[model samples]
Target chain A: MASSEEFNLDEYILHHLTDSQEWHLPFLPTIHLPEWLSLHGVMLLLSSFFLTLLFGILYKKEQRVPKGLTNLLESFIIFVRDDISIKYLGKEDGRKMAPLFCNFFFFILMLNIMGLIPLFSTATSNINITAGLAIITLTFMIFGAIYKNGIKGFFKAFIPSGVPAPVLILLIPIEIAGLFIKAFALTIRLFANMLAGHIVIISLLGLIIIIGKVALPAIFLAVGIYILEVLVAFLQAYIFTLLSAMFIGQMLHPDH
Target chain B: MTAATFATIGAGLVTVGAGIGIGLIAGRAMDGISRQPEATNKIQTAMIIAAALIEGVAFFCAVICFMALGK
Candidate 1:
């Protein structure tokens, strides 16, 4: 982008879309590492570390009638546990999965909020990151299904009970496919929402460059969008966590 | 018109449809809440879920439109 003399929208958008920087192992000469490190991945690791360290320090300061930042953070934790995890995942399983739900909610919330900040890239905006999160969710769902039902019972999920012999053949494949579809939906939902929000913001700003004379109105519109993007950041994080819990709940106690 | 123009038009068409679908969901949800203010939370929750589902479909269309741009 910097190399080109004339500004191109395609290059501008593509530049913003791509990971700008990455890090790789320098010491391991013999070991092969894939294109593993990226801006989003680094941000993810930073947020994870921040969450852990913050929570670790906060854990020691716990008191009755929680106060200050601790109170606010605790409320968030309780909300995720009760509203998201327990509400969807059920009392028994939800209680067991509360820690995980809190982690998912906080981790995503951190990443989404960070993305809004100037100069920081959105980790969740990356499909790979969101897909990784969705896969973790799917793994939880699968394990929950197996734990609730035996191995045979788990496979039996693909075929609904009391179905016609011929219908079973068609139903089984569809049901199995549905399992992956759910995860894919989860991945796309988060990734697309995050990505679209940024794209919209960048495009709005680009309007100023495209129409140089009407910069004032375009700037105003872009500012409005920036605020909405802040709200969307939180909303998307919450939605992702809530849907993951619901998917896990459905698997834990299959209604069909 | 070039493929890019068509892709832009297609995306606009998709947005038109999605806007109506989401608007319908939101309008009904608002009506329901107005009729029964006590059930506002429930209505809002249902509205969000429906809107998200509709938005998901719109996003799928958007992905197709994006692919069309490349071709």
Candidate 2:
């Protein structure tokens, strides 16, 4: 176990929050290996395992009517399917894409919620995790667009129909850049939201230590921020999944 | 200024931008919701998602600031 003195609050928070990755330095002499496994990776696995267990328990009973945890889970699943997936991707496409979107939504939701738990870290707080998700969505968008519109149609969609030949030259690049920027934005957005919430909470708490025990107002501020952070936990998760669906929807029917 | 102070500033700017973006989104969503109460669920849901996306960007900015401060 690490000593308390060796790991202060800032260090403790940073240590828990950092990712574990192996880096190579072919041209350089030093490459630091992170001391801890990526919290996001662990949470990803844990959420998957929990989802499996929940499904297994539900299946084992073979209950015709939903009850208890199963019912709650069913409602969430239905909400994603009906509201997010179906509403965005449409019935036929949504049905096909349901599992992917469902997984994405629940996985992100669980990860966001994890930060709220004491002594646990949030996976979604990590940039790599959010970037990975954004990349996956980007890939789906690209492939889905190609599949729907064909390669010729896909490229053609980049140029707005009303633009003249001369303007098309500039518009096409701008449009392409816009597509990439949107995906890049998604990555930064998720990473920033999750990280900021924790930081605010930490900074608020840090005030007690910085200003000493007599700072009663700081304590109240910290408590208030904590409550806001709780709302943020849910809000961030909802936003991440919603933007993802919107991106997918745009790619699916670009003409709109 | 110390790295930590710089980070604090950077994080502050990010949140400010996010606050503005969210305010706009919420304003529009509220307008829609008020006009059509029947579509409140849909509007609210869309608003929440848009808010998250904006928040995500702010979150990214915060993380970068943290890293800068730590170093």
Candidate 3:
């Protein structure tokens, strides 16, 4: 970004998007964290620590009446339990799995919201992190199905009845691939969304740098995208949890 | 033409495809909600799920285009 000989716009935008040891912000000096732990790593750990401390302290009060933060957290938990988990999985399994679904929702929601804050970076924007999260969902989807339905039932779920034996040869592979494709879609949907959002925001600002004037409309557009990013942060988290519950639900009750 | 150019074009087409698919879904959903306003909540939920599923495919292809651009 520093105009040495010639400034490269692509490099500027990509640099802001990619994770690094140093945190960069407009009109502020770069702050360098430890080389071993990248900026995104710090953001990831920060969100986890914040969530744990917030919940651990608030719930430890053990109040007969829920207070401010406790009230908020409880509401979110109920939303996850009822709207997401129970709605998809049956009542019994939904209750059993509410905790895991809550963890996914809050962790993702926090990670995303943290990114929107100028002080922190977006950890979920990274492909590896999103892929890791999707893999956890995949593990539960595969194992939960097998556990509830047994091995025979797991495979049986793939083979729909009355789909002639001749069609079975072509259908089996596609059905098997569909399982993995769902997880792959989950990974890309998250990574690309965050990636695209950051890129657009940076590019909007980059226009001013490249063109050598403070583009006022560009600033407004960036702010608009920033707000959309916030909405997306929440939406993506909800969608991920919703889909994960849906996948597991589908597995548990294949007939449904 | 360069590979990136082709990838860019392909991504544009993917977006168009996803746009039409979602448009169709939202159109039908609107009709359903208008006919049975009481079921609006259920209809909206189904609409969002379907739209998100198609958006996922679009993003997946866009990511592949990005890989090509990176190369």
Candidate 4:
């Protein structure tokens, strides 16, 4: 119900960016648990719950053959498995990893899209959320590599073939650094894209107020940015999922 | 500069960095696809995924800006 004129740009944007939390613990000081029944938490739970229910319904009706929504969902699943997982990970290994990759994609895509809504704080926009996702991917990459190549082979994989002994001294450190860097980069990408789109949209909207009542041009610019942001919402989500699949694929087939 | 101004600058830089990274990824992907048209789907998919990984880093930078600026 707040008007643009009355609202402070920084405060307004901050309010939207802030996660709804439960009461702050007086004793714990640092622990600011989201209010147990916050809108954000509730939305997250509900979205997850509904997704699970949909999956259940599809599973139970498996014998009936896919149709309508079920058909669409099945097609998407098959596309990710065949196109992304198998293409990168190879057919045999890709099947095992498909579900995990698919889940990560959809979960992130949904969360990113949710932020575009009028009154939602994107959980994926949070560092904790993005970091957790990066960690999950990292865990999969490390463990999957070790599992496929064995511990010795895993370490050996870092040293590309044909490198001289002296070069290895430098290569080993660079390779190790690259491994961690890739994971750290993954964490930043998703978080930044989501956050950037929102900030831009909010800042553009703030322009109308900043320039005062006479700035009609600013209003038009803000509208344009808002539309652009809508497109970015989907693009960012797609980018996040696509990278996750690629990382997993790389780990699955280091030779490639 | 006020925290707000700093946050704006920080966010702008992150996006610029992401743009450059994605441009590189897409360029390589296109080159790969051209070499093997039959593998275009696979190459395109891989490119998109790589772009996302880069985006994740940019996202983290933005988050830091938000934390610094937000009350």
- TM-scores of the candidates are 0.88, 0.80, 0.94, 0.77
Which 10-residue window in model 1 chain A sums to the lowest lDDT? Answer: A24-33
Q: In angstroms, how far off is A35's CA in candidate 1?
A: 7.3
Q: Which ten residues in a row have the lowest lDDT in candidate 2 chain A?
A: A22-31
Candidate 4 lDDT, A175-198, residue by residue in tens: 878877777787777666666677
Residue-level error in angstroms, candidate 4, position B62: 5.8
Off by over 4 Å in 2: A1-12, A20-39, A58-61, A216-223, B1-14, B53-71
Error of 1 at A9 (Å): 1.8
Report the CAPRI category for model 1.
Answer: medium
Please provide, for model 2 over B1-71, each residue's C-alpha lDDT reduced to its tens digit, 9 standing for 90 to 100.
89899999997898789899999999999899899999998788778776766665676676688779878
Give the per-residue Cα lDDT of candidate 4 at A128.
72
Worst 10 residues of 4 chain A by lDDT: A22-31
- Kindly report which residue stretches of model 4 are placed more than 4 angstroms away from their true locations once superposed: A1-7, A22-40, A58-60, A63-65, A209-230, B1-43, B46-71
- Tens-digit lDDT track of model 2 for A1-256: 3543453677655654566453323456534445675445666777778777767765335668978877887887888788778888778888888788778877777777766776456778777888898898899889988999899878877878876899988888998897888888888877766776676677766666656677657768877877887777666665666677878888887787
Q: Candidate 4: give its CA RMSD in angstroms.
A: 5.8
Query: Residues A26-131, candidate 1, lDDT per residue (tens digit)?
Result: 4543222247566776788889888988788865464888888788898888989988888887898899999988888889899988888765678888888888
lDDT per residue for candidate 4 within B1-71, as digits (tens), equals 79889898988998799899999999888888888899997687667666666665666676688688764
Ranking by lDDT: 3, 1, 2, 4
iRMSD of all candidate structures: 1.1, 2.6, 0.7, 3.1
Question: Which pairs of residues have clashing backbones in candidate 1?
Answer: none
List runs of model 3 lying over 4 Å from the truth.
Answer: A25-31, A59-61
